[model samples]
Target chain A: MKVVVTGGTGMIGRKLIDSLLAMPELIDRDGNMAEVTAITAFDVVAPNPPLPDDPRLTIVTGEISDAEAVEALIDDDTDTVFHLAAVVSAQAEEDFDLGMRVNLDGTRITLERCRALGHVPRVVYASSVAAFGGNMPDVINDTVTPNPQTTYGVTKVIGEYLIDDYSRKGFIDGRALRLPTIVVRPGRPNKAASTWASSILREPLAGHSAICPVKEESKMWMLSPRRVVESFRHAQVLDAVAWGPHRVVNLPGVTGSVTESLQALSRAGGNSARARVTFEHDPFIQEIVDGWANTFETARGLEMGFKSDTGLDEIVNVFLEDDLPGQHVYYD
Target chain B: MKVVVTGGTGMIGRKLIDSLLAMPELIDRDGNMAEVTAITAFDVVAPNPPLPDDPRLTIVTGEISDAEAVEALIDDDTDTVFHLAAVVSAQAEEDFDLGMRVNLDGTRITLERCRALGHVPRVVYASSVAAFGGNMPDVINDTVTPNPQTTYGVTKVIGEYLIDDYSRKGFIDGRALRLPTIVVRPGRPNKAASTWASSILREPLAGHSAICPVKEESKMWMLSPRRVVESFRHAQVLDAVAWGPHRVVNLPGVTGSVTESLQALSRAGGNSARARVTFEHDPFIQEIVDGWANTFETARGLEMGFKSDTGLDEIVNVFLEDDLPGQHVYYD
Candidate 1:
């Protein structure tokens, strides 16, 4: 089996690649183990820390908006595609044309290329909870309609529709997972409005002070990097019959308020670690966060056997084990 | 105020144009009546009946998919746009690329041109009930997420999202009306899967035999041409504030089974007209009709003051008064 991962230079992409390399064998549709022979990490830039040496892995960098480049990258041999490349929410909102070009047009190009292959490759799209906003119910479910208020959200929702339609037409076997905000990210803060959710937890645990832009009570529906990567793998191997008509699913996650996250921090690294976080309310960030649906009734996702983080502490612990290894923890 | 109506040669468009020319004045944002100086009827072909020759009316025939042509047509002076042009369902399904070009890309071009004007124009989009399908509820409501099963439906749903986003950005004040299947259409049947909904009534009423492709129990949510034309005008002059955050609304309509419709036909033209209809079960048409949601709870549309045909008889009466004037109704 051959696979392609778009946005392969990003943190999640890198982690997912690592997991794939660790277990190069995946279950094929006929219930037989298939060995992944070639894995292409296609992105706009080479991995910063550089990926671990693997004979099967190849890194190819190019513009996602370029149809020819995407078409070339997704050759006829490509059996699966993990499409994660996108402009972050804040960046998309700031530059409308850039967002439309990359987020919308790029996805279309990728889908078109896959369709052209005519082999019915499995496509696992990394959609976001941002697809839910604007006159939302208190707790969103699979039935609730997506009315995204942001350009990024709109593009993501559009991607979900395209994936669904493509799957329906038998062009490609597609699955779009509406991922929650990933918490305890290893890297520095990026342009996403939800960056603060991870920044507050990651920085403080690493013995550095971090700013919490929203209130302590601000809630976020979150998943760990570890679980999301697992989700990508699990979604790819599932029987096409399991997905049926709808190719989109809202992945399950733990809903945590900032205060609850801080408590989790205190449990993991004691009082001193929790004390490293400071509140500085940013209205712009708060307004964007407020529009997001922080709670979801993910019955469909759970029924499909997709898992979420057990607790905020577990998520923070996973970050510590996976990212901040060999660092000494300071006691209160 | 100068207005442009795409697909202007169609039945609804012509009726809307007539209504617009009759009034020639609309309520502006600041609660002032503004005179409509010009009305342009733009379409792929010239109006066959040649649209009542009025001094203020102009006919511009061109391809809707041509971006440059659309940009030229929707100049700065254009105050409102009634976007009704589309490749109907069956044609869209048969020719996917054509559908995408005309329905999706054409709408995008029109919106982009309006945005370039810098003067926010009121855009009334003609969406459809086809936007609802695939695991739908027994009765659809405003909150039901659109899961369009056809290419045309996908494009229309996409158009609604584009309009909502453009309006949210303050580029244009937009309203999308999800219209039901129009009944008693005067023209010959087109490529739409639901064309029989109109043909069953229209052909028989015109002293010609009509074939009912589905079973007697096959139900359709329907609107009259008069009510739909009124809806376009109503949607245009309403204050943007009235639309609020969500710009899409399911237009109100009467739901009737094929038997109910034929019974009304019997009432209007007696047994002879009803006898003119013959049952010929076409599985292809049946499949499409079965997928459609026959009942709706259009509270939003009702609350917003959009009206439906009172009954099937009233709809047939409108057709008689409007299309078949001076024709004798033979009673048994």
Candidate 2:
């Protein structure tokens, strides 16, 4: 079956596509074999992507918010829809109008199209821990009430509601996965609030010490790119009845404080790696890090059989393995 | 003390304005005398006001959503804002764009303007119990998370977030009151889904039987128009700190079934009123009513001293006494 991914040029989308490409056996159904039909991806800045040349893969380069583009994207063979399109936190905070039109309105058009279609498709929406903010309890569970503090969170919350409503109406088998910071992020970083997670690690590996915003005690939740991809794939085939009416669930991830992250870096890195890691606290980021939490009791997800990252050790190692392939790690 | 009411043309708005004009006690705080200086009310339609000629009241008629009109409506003497502008469920469910512009964007503009003027007014906003929908258990407490089910709820949810954000930033002392469905509604009938609560009794009063939406077994929450006024007034002067970080609180109300409502009507009617109450099952309305809910522990509001109409006997009497003044009965 053909899989369509919106916001395909972005960080998670790119990596997720790679993971999907790597998998030969995508549909694991009982007593039946399903073969790939096509793989289509799109973004605003049309990139000549390095996609599989096989007839099984088709790539489209356009803006997802465009109604015509989205209408053209979904076809008869299309069964899986992974919508990752959104203006990230920092950008959203800066430009309110752009955020609303793109994030809020964009999701609306996507939902409407899927709902208008006669048949239901399994839709995997990329929600964020940003969906929950304010003073969080030590471990936020699926049951904990999310009092979102920012525009970004509000938009996602609305998107979740739309997805949930559509699912209830039998429009689509929608699943919204609230992802944490994907540690050891690949590619160039944008102005997203969580970009520091990558900058702190990426800069150090690239022979430069990065500024650490927020306090050492400030904590955050994280998952590896590999795990993120796995979560997306898992959402596609999860038993809808088993999930019950809960279309949205908090994702499982490793929660760690800046101090713990730095320590892990030291353990994994030699003197050169350690030297590249430094601290420079910024008040704005501190306020956000304190307000936006990372530790959540993801009991619902775990109970549903979704696993979490081992720890910061595995998280850092994934980055080291992929980016600094030539470097040896003491922890490993 | 010019008190500007954004949605002053609405049912609760009219009652609230009447109460404010009658009592004049709202401005009892030392510097502000408990007497009306003027009343500036707005709506999409020409504010067909009751024409309060108490000499102190002045009505400025215009659309609250129009920024210029809102500015023109406000004067230097205005110290309070009872922002109640919103497209109700029936309208919101039909049009998404209208709901967003009215509920969410209008709120933002109002708060932003207040923020700009450095005027942190005592702004009492009208929220709804609908904000507390979806997977909600019986006897929902104020602390119990709001999982809004409809588009109207989404806007209210975002409105609460914006109110809290403004309050936290010291822009406005925003108080969000989650109002229960007001029963025995006065004036012309409305298309609000909850109107059946008032219609069933009102129609029968006019010697006509009404169709009962949903099964009689379905339970939901409700309040009277007077209680709605009381809740709004209470929110105006409540301790901001007591409201704490959460400006939103579910107003307490009666928990009962449609049969309970009809039974109360019959009991209160003494054969005369009994003839008017009849039930015919409509599947569509039944479907909607099945989704309607009424019940809240509301311990938070309880501690803060908010009250709901208790006992169908007492509630039915309140409706009769308030809406149908001459009609009264002592139910055994």
TM-score of each: 0.95, 0.79
- Residue-by-residue lDDT tens digits, candidate 2, B1-332: 67888888777777788888887766422334466567777766555535456676666666556777666665456677889989888788787768867886677677766655565677788888787666767667755666777778777877787687567657778889888777777544567666677777766665556656667787768887887798888877677867987788888888878778778888877566666655666777767766755767778887888877777677777766676642222111
Give me the candidate number with maximum TM-score: 1
B46-66: candidate 1 lDDT, tens digit per residue: 898789888999999998999
Clash pairs, model 1 backbone: none
**Best model per lDDT:** 1
Residue A129 displacement (Å), model 2? 1.1
Off by over 4 Å in 1: A27-32, A326-332, B27-31, B326-332
User: Residue by residue across A95-132, what tens digits does model 1's lDDT show?
Assistant: 88888889888998999899998888889999999888
Give the least accurate 10-residue stretch of model 1 chain B, judged by summed lDDT.
Answer: B323-332
lDDT of each: 0.88, 0.74
| Candidates, DockQ | 0.79, 0.36
Error of 2 at A220 (Å): 2.5
Model 2: CAPRI class: acceptable
